[model samples]
Target: MLALLRPALWLGSCLRGYHMHAASTQQRGDTSLVLVDEARRFIQDCLLRVGVSPSKVRCISEFLVVADYRGNYGSGLNRLDYYLSDLQSGHAKVGAEPSIISETVSTAHVNGNSALGVFVGNFCMDLAVKKAEDSGIGFVVAQQSHDIGMASWFTFRAAGKGLAGIVMSNSAPTMMGPNSKSASIGSNCFAFCVKGEEYHFVLDMATSVKDIGAVEWAWANDEYIPHGWAANEGGLSTCFPSLALRTPLLFPAGGHKGYCLSAVIDILCGVLSGAQYATHITMDQNQPSNLGQVFIALDPEFFLPNFMERFDDFCGRIQNSQPADDSEPIRLPGELERMHMNYVEDLRAFAYPNSLLTKYKEVAERLCVKPIELAFDRCQSRKSF
Candidate 1:
């Protein structure tokens, strides 16, 4: 009996060791819970090492990390690899400062000089907000920059300063119209923020059916995309290798209506700003490309003395409207994003797939930053929901 018991105990110990090793591997495979503050410091340190001003580095790092923490993976830390690629290939000039090329009392045009778009965009928005504060309106057109991340961030910043804001940017040619067979347009996006007495009304959306990053993420995760979500050679929905060959051209969310908005934005941001538009633009594959961004800020008080009160009342009425479903209530624009932000904050981690985590680790390794580690807890006591 003693010998048999010893053998069973030994077997159990081996099994436990195997489980421990497996758990460690799983932890290493997960990279969603990257320490925000640590990542920010790492990026700032890198920028400083590359001779960027400390204050500017802080601003750019905050924008990037905030997007990461809020689960906007496309605009988040994942973008660092692209920035690094541009820097290494000399497509993007690291540490190059942006300059105002032309200016008026209420408007300015900036030359980013191939700098990182986030830094350039922030600088432009700051100038626009300052002008609006003094003149009741301001507009800035920024050209020759890379991906600037989420448009909502810049608009929200202006809104926080008691100004209504609108932002639009033209990206690389990655979208196609319902009638077009190939990518003939950029994934233009627009964001708006209106000030109110209670809470601001913020709206941000990509003109495409889905963000390109979403498609890439789905493909990496072995997920099937809905047919209507992508375009094909015949201008119909398809998932063929060729259709999926490039960043699959996304259908506009509201069909032709969103396409119209995309066209308008491309015209205003790309053509009007004298930047490359549509198929003429090139992807950021270590090549010189022209991208344009436009930001507008308005002091609502200039139009109406009771604008804030009226806006707040309108928001309340919308919030208290009848629900479309018994379970879930209707939510205004920006409400869902705000909720997700809160949820991510409480969780302290995002539900990222292992594949994405692998890519992130690769990026961290390439950047010489310590790869993120995952934390997990096992609950022995189960509770009924």
Candidate 2:
């Protein structure tokens, strides 16, 4: 398998950014949680080590923390090594700004020019939201970026601004179609967000039963991955993540229906954006991945009256439904994520598993940055959504 996360050969090439002088006493404590402020510092410092500017680092790091805050563990700090590897290989450029290729009142085509994926994602989302506010809807296609990570950050940004938001990203394919084994289409992911008067509706999902990242986490932690999420090297079903990563094929979410839907998403994000799709997207670590992303935002007020109230009503109805188990309460989508964020807010820290703490320490050492200060506390780690 052509794993993008493989360690880069040119590790010293992208290490010229960031400032001199260090934060002393940064790595002194052992802790159960990483605070919001501490996580930001750690992220910023890591990005700086990779030659990202201070200003750009600020924007990029926030969403990474937000992913952890909202319990999207895969897209959070756990994925930092993948991104730094992209930079170290000189594929993901530092300080390259997104360029608009063409634009109409409500639509746009952009070339990210190999910028940081988060920077490109934010640039597209901001433009989409502005256009939506002006013209009732906006659709933007962006190319030459990879791994935007946690699309909900962009989707929820638009939803917070009174717009219905949709974000989709295409990846180098690892999914297998019905007949072919090996690897085929991408494990494409999308995120949708809309606002209710009382709640935010967030549906962020990969077309696969579970993303490869979750499977990897299971492998590293020696936890059991549920059946049907992945397959072993021979392309047969397996709950073992270690064996699954040997070949790295994830099962489709809805069997045939999911395979087709994933293809359509590849069309929207890849083909429609004039980039590669499916097996065509590059996997070579030393070159730009040239993946494409799409963002669409719509002003709900333009098409419907009492939109928030109606959405809230639907959320209420869903939550009020009878549960299969008497003790477990039915919750709306994004509810548990909200609860997790609230938990962090209440504690003013992230009580992550010990593995993450170890990962953080490793990343800090590798990047030559101060590790995030963690103060030990004895508490059960909350299940990440």
Candidate 3:
């Protein structure tokens, strides 16, 4: 679970115990290929230092690492700061647990009790998978949680077990409404996953054209964002990452379609679960998010008995289709994630940007946790993963 890795291993590919300071001094001009185990341990140790439950730390790490491995870099280590900030601000309660408030044969409502979102996500996803096995379908919702990291973490777990999975969560207002001057809507996100015989399809995305993390990355690298991605305080499309970050009026993906889709997810995760929706979920400013979420699992065994065969047929046809550009073959939803997984496994490590690595190292220095092992010299590896 990345900004940890899906194929994380404790010992392999490179030397260990190498600290950031030992590698570089002032200019963070290049990336590092870090041992997966070292990175995972670093995240856990940092969270532990911040008072997270030992057992719950694994879930949070899994969420982050998976996102990074799946190419959702914005949700990966790029987001570690958000979690640490919450704990440091005393807004996120340490070691809090979720409780089920009500349930039926195929549905349940939960109260996260202000726990870190990953803990809540783990509990709810487990319940959903179990219920789907027993009843053919499971639908669970929760309120009072924090950020759940990535929706793919929940769906990936279920799809890996041969079930279809769906997840959605509401968020702070980070997108703009049509004609609005500043951000006035949430970037509500959702993910869907399903497994076939030889493939699994995963779709994880924000309703907005892009998420805040993507914007942050562009800004950090001193690059202009793509046109149509977001707007500035003046409600005009702007390429300036700093301006976009300042006002944060992300353009809805596909215009009205994206807006409506986010609204629908908000109703499911926020309204139904009694959690704050849209603007009610505050941005930064040291306040608990109290976010709402929905997790669902459906068993193929109970329906579509030829599910795998049908999926193969569908894939074969797509695979055979001719591409307009010979170099750019069509790809399925989770293909990039699978490719990243294999790339890391082959190298036995994860690649990280110098900017992010510097921040992570600073975190370790500040918290007194062990530094995550990393390699900066070109002799260590020929290229970034």
Candidate number of the best TM-score? 3
Candidate 3 per-residue C-alpha lDDT over 313-365 given as tens digits, one digit per residue, 9 for 90 to 100? 88778877999999978878777667767766766566666677888889989
Tens-digit per-residue lDDT, 266-374, candidate 1: 8888887777787777765667546888989899898888989989999999888989886877677877566656655654444445566687667666667665553
Candidate 1: misplaced stretches above 4 Å?
Answer: 1-32, 38-55, 232-236, 239-247, 377-385
Return the clash pairs for model 1, or none.
none
Q: In terms of TM-score, how similar is model 2 to the real structure?
A: 0.86
* lDDT of candidate 2 over 1-385, digit per residue (tens): 0111111101101111112122232221112455678878888999899888888888878878888777666777778778888888967887688999999999999998888778888899999999999999999999987778888888977987999999999987777777556779888998999987787788888888877777765554445566787787778888777888887888888898778889999999999998788889887879975889999999998888788899889888888899999897887678767766766676566544456678778888988899877633333433221
TM-score per prediction, in order, is 0.83, 0.86, 0.87
The lDDT per prediction is 0.69, 0.77, 0.77
Tell me the alpha-carbon RMSD of every candidate.
Answer: 9.3, 9.9, 6.6
For model 3, the stretches where C-alpha displacement exceeds 4 angstroms are 1-29, 377-385
The deviation in Å at residue 84 for candidate 3 is: 1.1
lDDT score of model 2? 0.77
